[model samples]
Target: MSKAVRAVALVLGALWTAPNTVIGLLGGVAGLACGAQVHWRPRDLALVFDRWPWGPGGAITFGNVILHTGDALDVVCSTYAQRAAPCADPDIVLADHERAHVFQYMALGPLFLPLYLLCGGVSVRNRFERAADRYAMTGRGWWPWP
Candidate 1:
């Protein structure tokens, strides 16, 4: 990705995930101030912050810090994985899957959050998610549902 496109993605991602970013930044600062160890690494478009595992795995956010479990960063983006062990290169299919989410965010802006929440009913969410997964797996087609 060119620097210009990366810059735009950063801005758009920050905007789309503004609420999460604020909470994440505060959490990160608190973690730092309290002496909670943090591991930072550069990823495709953002930084990955490995915090003490509080749950099963990590979460992907559009913010600067992508939180993850101590084991493996649960989140995967275009070409980055958060882990101490050397991770294999990102699979093109998985990358495409995540790219679809990025596009969804771009298309919906802040509305994406509420819409995503509203779509939480298994059937609806699955429709969208399946489309993305299929796109990744097939390397062709667009999301089937709005």
Candidate 2:
């Protein structure tokens, strides 16, 4: 890859591990404020939990399997072994909503994470939830719970 590409990769990699630095911090905080917790798991999966009050909700990531918690987009599993169970007792009503957000990340690519953070810290959690719901409504046909 070219030097510019490499630099961008490095920057993104660092942001992935921890997004509370420099401009990336702004995004991270925004996401958190919006109730979008960023899970920097070791694997290449970005799980988005749609929890209210910052602790209860659904999550989504891409791997090799799909987890159904009554959501639209399913968490992609990483391997065939993971495909055994499609519905997990995740105990959340918005797994599918979060999954759609995960798709949003996919659409935004690297910029998604940072933007999520910023949104979290900037917007009120409820507003963030509504915004996410709006996105899901148009993109995934799911409405936010009242």
Candidate 3:
């Protein structure tokens, strides 16, 4: 996609997921206050919004917390701390997986949140997550499976 198109998409995507992004920003600030370093990758904004809510194994059960159980994004808020550089081999695979979820949010728009909750379970097992996994593992050519 062209730069302009991509920019528009990002803006729209951010807007579509604003609630989650805001929560993420707040969580990110808290994480920073708690000594977690911030990381950002230019290729995709996911890393930019990513934040390790608390140290490993630490849980803070609040709004949308479940959405960030793993390397997740409830529209925003990632629960891991790492470099902001371009993803490498294995990391790229993982990033692809998460990227698929981004597309899911884009497609579902406002309905993504409720549907995700309704789906339940982790991404590996959830229906929506499985679709994302398939998209990542395969491609978008065969989406909205029958």
Candidate 4:
């Protein structure tokens, strides 16, 4: 993509996904009140809040924001296995999985949630989650659409 094209795409994607991003920001701001810390993940094109005060220990993505219950994004955050991940020592980054969801949100906008629920709403059978898992592992093919 040319520079101008990429810039336009970025603006359009941000606008297209803004509603969901607003919802994420609400949670992120709440997390802030509860002592969570936020960071920018340029690689994921998202803002991540670490040590969020709710839910089981892991992470969740809403548009371009990721709320994680852990101290960092450098370790495996999924309940599933990632033994072959690219971390230097033990564990691996789970940002890729959530980032996949962010991209999904950008592509589908407000339609992503209903479609996700229809696809099984976060489980082994959910094509969205599966595609995300595949992308996090192999680093490609994050798009769930045929």
Clashes of 4: 0
lDDT tens digits, residues 25-95, model 3? 67766766655555554433553323454545322221222213234332322222213234331222444
- Report each candidate's C-alpha RMSD, comma-separated, in the order given: 7.9, 12.9, 8.7, 4.0
Q: 1-146 in candidate 2: lDDT tens per residue?
A: 99999668645644444322233334434556765444443222333222323322233232211222222334432221122345332322244445444444434545555556665632335333444545443444322233
Candidates, ranked, TM-score: 4, 3, 1, 2
RMSD of candidate 4 to the true fold?
A: 4.0
User: Candidate 4 residues 1-146, lDDT tens each?
Assistant: 89999878877887888899898899999999999999999888899999999997788888888999999876865423333345333333588788888888888888888899999886766889878877787778789875
Superposed by TM-score, candidate 3 places the C-alpha of residue 27 at a distance from the truth, in angstroms, of: 1.8
Clashing pairs in 1: none
> How do these models rank on lDDT, best leading?
4, 1, 3, 2
Top model by TM-score, which number? 4
Better model by lDDT, 3 or 4? 4
- Candidate 1 lDDT, 14-90, residue by residue in tens: 57766655655666666555443555544323344455345454344333444443444433443222122365544
Q: How far is 95's C-alpha from truth in model 2 (Å)?
A: 3.0
Q: How far does residue 39 in candidate 2 sit from its true spot (Å)?
A: 18
- In terms of lDDT, model 1 sits at 0.50
Q: TM-score of predicted model 4?
A: 0.87
